[model samples]
Target: MPLWLLLMLWRGSVAQVLSYKLKLQKSMTVQEGLCVHVPCEFSYPWLSFISAYVSWFQKGADVNQDPPVATNKPNQKLHERTQGRFFIRGDPQTGNCSLDITEVHMGDSGTYFFHLGTYSYLDTMFSLNVTALTHTPHIIIPGTLESGHPRNLTCSVPWACERSTPPIFSWTSAALTSLGPRTHLSSVLTLTPRPQDHGTNLTCQVYFPAAGVMVERTVQLNVTYAPQNTAIRIFQGSRTALGTLQNTSSVFILEGQALQLLCVTDSNPPAELSWFRGSPTWKATPICRSPILDVSQAGAVEEGDLICQAQNLLGSQHISLHLSVVYPLQLLSPSCSWEGEGLRCNCSSRAQRAPTLRWRLGEELLEGNHSNASWTVTSSLVGPWANSSLSLSGPLGSGLRLSCEAQNAQGKQSAAVLLLPDKPEPRTSGVIEAVAGAGTMALLSLCLCLIFRVKTGRKKTVQPVQSMDMSPAGSSGSGAYQHQSWTDIPAAPPAPAEARPISEEEQELHYALLRFPKPKYQEQEDIHTEYSEIKTHK
Candidate 1:
């Protein structure tokens, strides 16, 4: 052997190996109830010398048992489990071997290995791949309905195995023979549900030859709902009477008159009949063959609307009846001494027409009663309306119970009120007298102030003669008196003092001769003169 030759052969071997790699032409996936074909191709020049045996095996360590292969002679040991499920085809000249699988299941998902036999009598690994197949189909049903009406339901499988030849569909139920064509990949069943169908089980089954297995789903149906068409009827009057009709046709009645209200209704399964004056004030009564509600005449039955309702599984219906009652107009019953002075009472009548009112004390009708009473009347335009009242305040401490009676063409109604004496309010005369006395004192003080002002004014108007002189000390007091007397002399007569005319110098000397009392006294007099001068300046 030569080194160059050895290297060349190694190179040649590497190139050939790379060029002859195996390849699969087509890959396939099949549903659980279907079939698939995996086609493969490969090239190897040296292996062409001897016809290679084509073998296929699930990729596992125990491949010898489940080998999927093509051989001229059948291999009994390997054909045991895989006999019907797998088949293979190959062409020796082209070096191609492809395998087909039927009735694929979830367990069949794995790599498949292809092997080729060589002249050396050894099988060589050619190609490997993964095969995916669907598992068992799951069916689901969402809901069901019952009673009132029919409803449609749907049945569905998780996946469709379209590859199965002549896909099979079927349903099973005890209520019906096998549902053939109606069953599909996704089937819908519609029918009016009855109580009997509830809890019934339904099954949808599909079969496939390729898979050699059946896939099925089951569901239980539930049906439930309410009942229907409730109504009512009224009897006792000429208007559609159910029992004996009354002679008179009147919706109104006077106080103390006998009255009855009848209520009736028709229902399936016979509903319980109940009587109610107002809402929630219900009383259960025995239902007769001809169910009717009857109420006795009572003072409390003034204007009121009565409602009747029928109820069953299906639904409910309600109807209303209006009642009018009239009674005598009366003052409120005088409350007892313990009850207080608020004495009030009511009068009502169910007469068909408006009634007249009369109030009386004992047996005699009183004129004062009419004067003390206030009246209000109300009229309704619609079919049955009621008028009610609340009364307040009346005479107290009258031992008698005042009666008010009302009469109509049909009958008369009356209501009485008892009077209870109330303690009179305490007298406030002393307080009023105190307030008046205080006012008189204030007025007297004001009058005194006015009288003082008028006296002062009169004194100012009447000038009085000064008996004593307010003159300088040491000076002749008679001089001031004489000066005043001279000034007081009337203008019609000339004073004797003024007739004696004195020279200017003599007048000055005379003033000099008239000396002030003392230096301190003169100083004080000068200060007074200075002050007067300041006042004049200002």
Candidate 2:
């Protein structure tokens, strides 16, 4: 043999010996109580020879002390430590050394080593990591579940891996005794819930083989729906009232006076309807049997409420109505008394409808016999601002009371005033007399001033010829006329001394210098009288 060929053969042997290797396919993590598969593969021709001899070992107290796990020939030293917790299934012929661990516990997590014994020698070791699966499924619940309504719930994994097996699902509730079908990942559990199943505790449990029985996931369920079982209640003012079966008795009146009752109740369904009254207990009663009840006029019923119920399959509801009875209008005693100088009174009536107003003196209607007396009637409707008034008047000294009566379909209201003679006040009459006397005096003064103006004009015409002579006779005549004219003017008594007759221009300047005096009634009256007289003369 050549030396180089021998070296080549030796190198090939070394390479084959050094090349055999095993490791986990990829990193993996698993929850406790779940199943995990630790992937493993090897490279070695001896794998086929000692396929059954392949053993798994975990790192021990020392670097050299690798403890053996399930294998064809287990060492007592290794078997005592890791028995029953791990199992291996693989084909050494194909160089596959993978492991499948079931019911994995927290203690099963650690580094693993695969070793093969062949030809009386242990080969180089292959390393792997065995991690316990440690996650559980999560459950979520939505707020409400109505009967015949679709519901959605979810279960999911907190952490997932491509190699990790998808979780399986099972549902349990007080209403359901057994688990249902398994659900898929990212899938919704949809169901139409019913009322009967409301308030039941629903649970979703997740299964992972590696994380054993004690670590399942679960969640609770809640549901809501409409109401049921409605009823009615009644009250009057503050006190509750009971239905009665009495007929025309004092409780019943010809005019109409009645009591009202109110009804109320609670339910999920809203209540509808107004106040209603009848003998619900007595089947034979007309009102009880009839769909509608006729209100009685003779026996006036008072205001009351009728309550009606609204209901669903789940619960009942209630509402109310107010009822008022109409009464006939009537006057009682027909007597009159004064109110603010007006007469008021009530008249008696037995008629079913309010009586129309007709004044009667000793049983005869006043319209025919009383030609002097006046009468008025006023009526109003139940609501505000609905009113009508009628009035009649007669001789002032007739010694009769004037009456005002208000009537409605239900009742009457009236007022009156006495027709007594009223004497006029002396002071008020005296003021009128003084005004007349002053007016007469003013007329006389106005007539005198008109006569004086005519006399002054005549004197001026006669004196103009005499003034051409510049004679004493002319001057004396002018002075006398001026004095008489000033006396007739009756203004400020000529200002104590005679004032020179001012020209029109001078008068204007004087007016400009003087403040205008405020007008007085007496001055205005005199002016008005003078103007009237001048108009009469024209």
Candidate 3:
């Protein structure tokens, strides 16, 4: 072993080691069901070997017995796990050994080395880290979503390799959707949103068959819409809500009652609610700028329309209510009067609306123009007032009752009177009593005259005193007497009495005239006088 021989052997070994050099990426990361590219370059000492090939083999394996994971050599065998998914790019003659892998699985995660034909091998190796798929589907929305309008949406996985198996695509949403075009990388869907579909979720899910894994993406829908289903709810005072009116309606409210009206609508964006006094148009000013309209007095509300309008940026809607205020019934006093032999009675009543009138005979109720043997009834209507009259045609019964009744939708009223058959008429009874008393007084005056004549005859000779007769011109009857001033009358001397017995006719005609002094009491302002004359036959 001389120094010169040792030097020659060391130089040849150094040159061979420098020629078999490899430039490759040290490590690469790939997701399951995706592809990865490993760039590599190398230099070999065999420059005369044309039409050469390259292969890749898993590290820590026997290169002489085990097949390569990927190869470009003709008639060369490959590993079953990476036969179709792994390939070596570029020719070995150009010293380019780039490796490409599609649909990489967890089992493919290992270190691999480059092999140059059967005699050359690169010591430099690269590691592949195959992790679970974390790539989610991408959802692309081209434009804004409007309610009731159709639009297209796309979901795609652009990172996936073209050589990989096509993934299964599915969609989940609450909106109306239909299938559109589809490809190995992307799927298209036609979506029609509604007002109710606003703020809802839409999901695009994809299934990788090669790796048996699923990936998904979710997006919230923002749908714009106009007002719809506009309505008004009515509430009386503090009570619960009553009817709901979607369009025009008529409502009858009692006078002076409180009311509440609420307007409501459905839309994507919230709508503005307002209340109007009458039928509203687009330019009408609103009375209230809120959803609720409170009326303190129903009677004060005019007989017209009340409108509730709901408006938004997209469109508007409204509802109307016609208000009618009603009042209670009122009745006037009834009257009854005598019309010849029949009794007539009248009754009248008035109200906000026209009222009806009727009659009650004792316990029976009668209406319209009723005619019977005993009584008759007639009715008439004039504006708000209703009138009725009753006539009794036959003789009245003892303690009989008659009534006039008036009624309307609000209330009813009646007036009654009692009649007695035995009672006399007021004017005739007074006249009869006065005449009887006057007759009695005349008889008493005659008797007093006879007494006076007997006394005078016994005391003195029967002498006749000639007295001036002041009787009126009609003086043939004994009852006739002369009229003198009440203040200056003198006492009369007794006339001579006749000896013969008085005849019955003369006695009937006989009368006495008496004068009484004025009463001393200042309280008495009037005096009553009766005159009768005494007549004698000799």
Q: Give candidate 2 regions above 4 Å deviation.
A: 46-51, 61-67, 73-82, 118-201, 204-226, 229-538
Q: What lDDT tens digits, residue by residue, belong to model 2 across residues 281-389?
A: 2232222222223343323343343434343445444333444333444333334334444444333333333344544332334321223344555444332223333
lDDT score for residue 432 of model 1: 37
Model 1 ranges with Cα > 4 A deviation: 23-43, 46-53, 58-78, 87-100, 105-112, 117-170, 174-178, 182-201, 207-215, 220-538
* Model 3: how far residue 486 lies from native, Å: 30
Indicate whether candidate 1 or candidate 3 has the larger lDDT: 3
Residue 353 lDDT, candidate 1, scale 0-100 = 49
Return the top candidate by lDDT: 3
Clashes of each: 21, 51, 3
Full-model lDDT for every candidate: 0.45, 0.43, 0.76
Ranking by lDDT: 3, 1, 2
Task: Give the 10-residue window scoring lowest on summed lDDT in candidate 2.
Answer: 529-538
Shift of residue 500 alpha carbon in model 1, Å: 99
lDDT of 1 by residue, 1-538 (tens): 9999999999998987665656674335555555667676767667657556666665553444454433433553454445666666667467766666655666666555665553211233323233444344454444536454645555555465333344466666644232212343555555565545657887766676555666776767665533223233334335454333222222544556544445444444345444444452335442332345554453554457555555555444455555556544332221112224443333333334455455555666632123335322222212221122223345543465465565556565555553323322111123332454467456543432221111322323222222323354345532232222111211233223212333334321100011133322222333211111000000
Scanning candidate 1 in windows of ten residues, the lowest lDDT window is 529-538
